[model samples]
Target: MREEKGVIIRTLQEDINNLKIEQASTLHQLSSTLSHLSSTLSQVADLQHEQNALRQELRKEQNQRLTIQEEVNRLKSKGCQCDNSSRNSTLLPHDIQTVKEAITFDLQLEMKQQNDSIMSEMSRMEKDVRDVKAKIRATAMTISGLVSSVSDLQTQIYFSAGTIRDVNKQWKTNEIIVFPHVLANVGGGYDASSGVFTVPKSGVYVLTCFLSTHSSSMYAKLILNGNPVVGITAVTNDVSDVDTGGNAMVSRFQQDDRIWIQFYIGHFLWTMSDASVSTFSGFLL
Candidate 1:
């Protein structure tokens, strides 16, 4: 009996160790996910900055064009005043014509330069607009994909027992131990009232069971759909002896499959102040 007890203890310890490893892995995955999201947000910020800069440049170009138009209008008004003064004064007709020709030539040259500059700037602006539009579309698609990824990660199935009341209940053979306390029931898979977890999906899952016994030997089994998959025993050699046993297992189950813990032989001693209360928990991989 001692050798068998030793093996059971070792097995339970191994299961707990394995669960710790799995928990670490899950944490690492979450960290990676957060890092990726941060990077994506940074990219989005950069794109927004580029768009703002582009808009500012467009406004600056428009203001420059308006200033050029005002200068052209001022030059035309001065030319018209000069023509009227020449007509009233005693100036030679050929000299007056020469002055008018020079003014007309200067105005034409200024208008051509302004038009060329505007056309070149507009062409460049159009290209920039196209590039920005393409980048915005790409960023939008990336954000959509990230949102879907986050949603998939959010869909998790897990549960844990809450603070169990100290009842000191004596359980007979093959009686189901109902842990009324419920700490968590993500995906609504575990029924605290029934002390049974109904599998929410068809997948591999990790299940754990713990028990604490005082002054009595407790034998229990982790049951799957009414069949025993694993057994745990907590034995006490003296009246004051208190022992605790825990077991964890990774198994695959179909949707709607039931899991619970059953008492084989034992009297459970529990208290509100006790630190080593029995617990049951499970989660999908």
Candidate 2:
């Protein structure tokens, strides 16, 4: 009876030790899992932060664009005929000539003023764009840092971000691809022709177009989705001087967005000289 009791006590001791071992193993596994989860959450938080920063930057850009557009509209309204009625009351042939001359002078002055205003507006727009670009660079840097830190925590959390150009050969006219959007073609034409370009994906995209001219007083205006954008003009009447050169138009696109460039076509005689139409190119960011 004494031997049996001793055996029973030893069995109980062994079972207790086994249970303690199992408990320790469970605690270790839980700790590891919790650590991994914490790392994942950290990465997610970083990404969310990046997204919010980008949104703020985007809002700034949009506000700038709106401001510029308003300025443009104001300028357009000012483009109407300059009124010089204060100097027009004396009716005589000589006075009429004088009035005509004065009106011409006033027109020239207004034109100069308009040109100056346009330059100022353009400078502001460029500055704002640069600011946005800097923000993007900063965001990219932040992402790089986050990615580096998370690399040790998880090997599969890296994101590939870059630009790709000329993904497809067939582009439609008037198709514009805005940033955060894929490229789209509105109508089909190649080389310097004005048409809409569309976006197939949603992301940031950089766009470019090329147009050329061989005649003086000839200008090409690039329009993004029916909105007038950049303008290029030739200084000489030589084909090669303006020839072999293409007007590059760039704009950010969104999904299902459209863009295109239209030339004044009055003096731009080189549209079909070298190429049949204008060509548009862009990439995903």
Candidate 3:
């Protein structure tokens, strides 16, 4: 009976040790997960802070650009008016002839000399105005570019997916794909329902689109102003392993140009895992 009790105690002690070991291991895993979560949260906060700073900077630049543009228009309207006013300041002639003819001649000569001096001064002033107008034009072009860049920064848009959940679908050849879910749109240029991004101003842009395939061979292209700027093609045959292809381009766009994607004939885009991880992204370059 004593040996039996000893064996029972030893078994109980071993079970307690095993439980302790499992508890420690579980605690370690929880600690690691918490640490990783904290790091991810910190990174998210930093990204938010950086985005806010960029917004503020863009706003500041846009305001400054507006002020400069207004000045340019105003200066352009006031151009050459100074020269016209100078020409209109010339005095008329007088009607009198008598013993004061000598005095009249002297007065006429003096007036002519003064008028010549004024004309010379006006010419110099006009030259100065020309120089200023040139400077304003150069400044206007520079500021216009800056305004476009900042406006592009302010007018960003990204698409992730559509609202069509689990709907078996196929995009026909030359048909457009509309992403119903918009992740971000700075300006109202991007239409989520139509999946078209309209260019608000003329400038160069960097565009990227990702298309995922499940089983159908697919070829998609980014269409800008009814022309293909970039294209990608992919084919998937296995269900367990999916395939994805993407197209990117740095293309020049004009104002009011509509940008979207079109699938080629005999190709289709598919949904994988009940979620649309496919994305379309772009920014002004």
lDDT of each: 0.71, 0.45, 0.60
- Comparing 1 and 3 by lDDT, which wins? 1
The model with the greatest TM-score is 1
What tens digits encode model 1's per-residue C-alpha lDDT throughout 79-198? 677668877875635364466557667766766686576567666656665665666566566656656655545557778773446656677888878777776787999887888899
lDDT of 2 at 127: 61
Tell me, by lDDT, which candidate is best.
Answer: 1
- 2 versus 3: better TM-score goes to: 3
- What's the best-to-worst order under TM-score? 1, 3, 2
lDDT of 1 at 199: 96
Clashes of each: 0, 52, 0
Q: How accurate is candidate 1 locally (lDDT)?
A: 0.71
lDDT of 3 by residue, 1-285 (tens): 224324533654564466556556655655555555565556556555655665565566556556655654454444344335546754422222232355545555655565565556556555655654565565556556555544444443332334324325766878887776666564467788788888766777666676666656678888887888788776776654456677667778888899997778434455545455465656554
Model 2 per-residue lDDT at 97:
42
Q: In candidate 2, what are the lDDT values of residues 39-158, reduced to their tens digit? A: 655655665665566667566665665666665556444432223432463442334445555655665566557556655655665565565556556555655555544432231110
